[model samples]
Target: MSEKKSSLIPKSALTKAWLVWETFPQTCYNYERMMGQAVAQVFSCVIYYLYKNNPEKRKEAMKREIEFFNVHVEFGACIIGMAIALEEQKSEGKNIPGEFITNLKTSLMGPLAGMGDTIWQGVVIPILLAICIDLARSGNGNVWGAIIYTVLILAGAYALSYINFMFGYRAGSEAIMDFLEKGILNKLIKGASVMGCMVMGGLIVNYVSAVCGLEIVSSAQTYSIQTNFLDAVCPKILPLGATMLIYYLMSKKRWSSLKIIALIIVTGIVGGLTGILTY
Candidate 1:
């Protein structure tokens, strides 16, 4: 029986991998390949490490990883990390079947993609955009807003990938996912969703605007139905309600984005024509 190795993937090797990791989303996107080439690009070093003395084995391993891969790019590190360990084992002639590598990746990427969506889109981008919107409120063409968002996004993206890579690298495989399935990832996602809701609420209040043009005149007085009635009752309720309606339609009813937007536009036009909506 072969003894298990105890050495870590070197920092320098990881740094090289990280460079490919950061750029793959932009450089390797394709309808057919879909980050498959990017996966090959990033993990080439790992395969090289495993087959440094065997050119034919290295070429086959390189070809192996290039098969179609699709996932939210943020989760690539974890997948790559797992691949690294397996490739290393294979290099040591540990008799790990090639099917195990491909099968695990195919099964694993789906969950990681879900997490990546929640983390990268639902939470990270929204929070950053909200912050940038705050800066743009200063009304100076939002140059600073652009600058800040760019810097923060780049930094955040790199940092996020780095942390996930390190964690996945250290954990070595699906063992971490076993712990993740016990509701840890779920709770984190839920907490992030709560925070995302708060930010989204703030965004709706600040960005979404709606008004009722209806007004009633009584003995030398006028009252706007929107400002006097709705706003007085619950500030910004129209925008808030509209936001919630869209949320319900999309989440519960499974409405498409285009369909929801069309509904809103159609409602606005009909309401404007019928005097239901006011400027």
Candidate 2:
């Protein structure tokens, strides 16, 4: 039996891989492998170090890495870390199969994509934009809002990728499976969903405006339905109701956003013309 390789993968190699992924995640994007090329590129240096003694093994390893793989970039760092650890084991003459690593990567893509996209796109981006928009408006077009957003997003993306990579490297696949089996990931997703809803609700109250122009005259006194009735019943009822209606249509009825938007525009025009709804 061949003796195991004594050398360990350097942190610099892993850092380079992470940077490669961040910089060119979709640069080689295609219908065939999605992010496959990027993934292979990420591990190029690692592959060289691990299989430099065997050109055939190095080629095989590179092919395996290039197999169809796609995931949210930040959270996908965990997968990259796991792959590095697995390759190291293989290089050490451990019983790790290349197929096992490939299969694991494929299986993880969807879940990580969901988790990453939800946390970053659905929750983080909207919240950040809301704050930044408010700041810019308050500052009368201050550049700080944009600067803060750019800096924070860049810092956050790299930091998240780095942390996940290190954790996955140290913990390996067992930790990830445990995370999935224990429903911690699901719980985190649910919590993120709730927070997302709260952010959207705040955004709706802040940005979406609907005022009813409908009024009633009784006993020689005028009362705005929006002010006297709707406001008394529930503040911002029109906007809230409209927003909820849009949600219902999109979620339950499976209506396209474009259709909903068109409907809203038509309703707005008709309401304004009929003097029933106003800004």
Candidate 3:
């Protein structure tokens, strides 16, 4: 790519936009809208610039742009920059199809979210925070250590976000086309989904706790259901069963997360009160 083409958005404006997105993406998250409006707001300048002469087209574009969107904010900046570049080229009467952009965003968001969450939330932030918190809690009472660590984290995150945005804009539609042509995007999305499921399964088995309240009484001795049967069969049978039931509720019955959570909360409270669940 040429140097001029690489600088699609001016560096100043792009950096400012990245800061706004980083600071406020979650501020506008709603159940129905998620980050839809926040995303549209982030690229409002690009949208207006691209469709300035055509008010009707601008309205149409903005309308579609603010549809339900939810992605990890850090990596989502990349996709947003790519969208802006695509929109810019489209405004120039390029041969790009609208559905192509829409489908690309839809398909890429999940995988990108998984990758971003794994790197940032699952690993980096936690590890850094743990180490810094240890320093903060050290006997010296030096709050500056925590403050410096936080500033460094913020600076590093900003740099990463900027890099991702610029990379996406420079790569643009061609990169997406390459992924499609090679059939890699689908695999990426599927792999992320599978990995997310596996993680959830492991967490469920490792953390979910329950114990049997029943025991089999015999003439000679009493066989405890939890110690004798459950432990003998499988260690996490209750948790595994609970996880499977929730999965069935979601996959088969199409239950909403809120409803499922409510059900679990109620079940937990009642079970704890009734001594059915040993916790």
Candidate 4:
């Protein structure tokens, strides 16, 4: 009774096909963070194209692609690059080299943040929002178009994650030298900064250009004094002034980011409540 138990499942055609999909992640982490995101974006675009072109099973395909981009592909490359550097240190019977690891992390994080913000928030999100908003405003409200955009975004995320995990396994320490020689980090950082500045300008116009009544109260019979210096000067001047003030405070006073953030929040709230400043 105990001997010769029959096997419930047998290996067949399905097992062979599964092996290739398992190996895909390894190829994704070979580059630095910016490069990884670029690759993920390309992959996502291709998937989107496929879904757009195909008629049958398009919905399912789009769903799967979106999941890939959002979950496995987005920041996966950076994680992969970090993992690779760590593993390399481990394999050589050496302590994770402090300087190398520190520089590698420092170098990648800024570029990655920039690239992620520019691509995801700046370009993709705005474009999608524009499309959906336009459609809605026109009274068409093409739900499929919105769905397609969403799928594209999610696909990009998943692809990034998958690529990072696998690349981390293969690249380890070697990627650092390659990354530096290629100057990919510098390019990414520069590009990201430009995008960030543009976004900041847009936000300043949209949110920070408003006026508030902060004039000192006068009991005189004849006239009232208006203390809105921002209104007197050019509308653009106020935001720039505020920005410069914060920058000066940080640079001159050596204030930490957290401290600056807290100070700004407190000042803003107090100023709003006390009518000393306006948004």
Candidate 5:
């Protein structure tokens, strides 16, 4: 490939493409194509610039990008950047196969999605939420907590997107392959999972409140089941048990969130009326 053709994709075009991706990555999201249309949308300008002289090639390039794609939004920027690089090479008259690009995208999306979800959803969000929840509680549910969380989340998302996108563009598939080969991605996922579990445990202990109201009254004296029995056996056992039960219902029984919520409401009402539970 000639040097000029290699540099056909100007930086300005890439900036615009990134903006497009950030703004409307899922505007046409559907089961049929998932994020395919958005991928094509992100590259519309770049593709046009690369293949303006050849209408047939331009159409083919657009069609190539608009294939089935689904990945985590933040980390998916890396894939988009790689796709742009591949498109540039193809435009430079290199012998890059369309199928190769498609297959690469398909293969990378799953692993990246797993990593993205684990790190962002599992670790980062939970920690941030734990802090923000505490802040809100301390402030009696003030909007400052919400506002701070919102600002931090938006800033973090955009920053990660830009960094990953730039890295992928400059480093290409080789860098990602190196990370995978070295098991770095796996370590990150595992670490994030552990951190997520720890944060959740803390949240449960602090947030979850379940008190036993049951008491046994005898001729001589009254026995407080909660204080004398449950507390003696385990502190915060009810909260822990409740959390585990909910987790089991969701994970093992495949119960929907709405269904579980309904169950909680019913249980709360029944337990309160029967005087078996409080708080």
Candidate 6:
């Protein structure tokens, strides 16, 4: 292929966007990483746009563009950005630069994973659920409250994604560095962690401590012993104990998550059938 045609076709923004959208869903579980990838794509797109608009600024733009897409560890936007850059470099016959870019991208994956788990899964999801449930309960079981909360949660998620994407794309690498130095991301992560912990405490008291049936079965006499250990020692201990047991099994034993879920379901079914538990 001719050099001009090759450069034009290979490093286009459309191609980078397509790659990001396609890869994002597959790696959606890694929220931070995905965000990084998204940011990366934004960076690439911005660079591509700049190249088209002003060919003279290409080298200078490339030198400083990495910072615009820098995300707090879990932002998958970096991956997308790096991938696009790598592709462009390959097309332009710059193998060593492409490898260096790849290395930089790989280095950030771990930190991003941790941040994503703490922020998105731990804090944001729990807070949203807690608010929705609280509103629904307070509204005399009005379903609309729950619906509204759900919409808010979705809106928050999408808004964050869109803002990050735009910031990365428009400002290039400098925006990311600025966000980090200002400590905005750190504060947000910390806030989310606090909220998540609060929600978890509430959940433990409300959902985790419940026990439905406690009377023991007797065939010959009308004698019954309270089967609930919690009632004997302290009320609402069964759910807490169950929660601890599950936590221990999963964390200490390193059991598979799927297996733990199946065990919980099966145990519940058996307990209900044996009249030891009730809804």
Best by lDDT: 2
Candidate 4 or 3, higher TM-score: 3
Q: If ranked by TM-score, best first, what sequence of candidates would result?
A: 5, 2, 1, 3, 6, 4
| Highest-TM-score candidate | 5
- How does residue 106 of candidate 3 score in lDDT? 81
Task: Give lDDT tens digits, candidate 3, residues 140-203.
Answer: 8879668978898888788888777776776785674565578665675567556666656666
Sort by lDDT, best first. 2, 5, 1, 3, 6, 4
Please give the CA lDDT of all the candidate structures: 0.77, 0.87, 0.74, 0.49, 0.86, 0.56
The sequence of per-residue lDDT tens digits that candidate 5 reaches over residues 1-279 is 111223787889888888888778897899999999999999886887788789999899889899999999888889888888877888888788999889989988998999999989988898898888778878556878888899999899988988888777777777777878899989988998898888888888888999999999999989988899989999888999999999999999999999999998998999999999986
Predict model 6's lDDT versus the native. Answer: 0.56
What residue runs in model 3 are displaced by over 4 Å at the alpha carbon? 1-8, 26-36, 44-72, 87-160, 217-219, 256-262, 265-276
Worst window of 10 by summed lDDT in candidate 3 = 1-10
TM-scores, each model vs. reference? 0.83, 0.88, 0.64, 0.41, 0.93, 0.57
The TM-score of predicted model 6 comes to 0.57
Candidate 2 TM-score, C-alpha based? 0.88
In model 5, state the lDDT of residue 102.
91
Model 6 lDDT tens row, 1-279: 111123343345544564454345343335334344344434455455435655654554444333333333325443443444344444455543544554545544444545667787897777677777777788467797679877886676555554443333344334444655687767877887887788777787776644556465578654223343546776666677787888899899998999898998998888788866766
Per-structure clash totals for the candidates = 1, 0, 0, 26, 0, 28
RMSD value for candidate 4: 15.3
Per residue, candidate 4 scores C-alpha lDDT tens digits across 1-279 of 111111211223112212222334334444334233333333332333333454553444333222212112344354433433352333335465434544554555455555566666765566565555456555555676677667776676556555653454345536644765688867865776677677666656544543454555567542212334544656666666667677898999898999888987897788788876664
Stretches of candidate 1 off by over 4 Å are 1-11, 26-33, 245-279
Clashing pairs in 1: 213-278
Residue runs of model 5 more than 4 Å from their true location after superposition? 1-6, 219-221
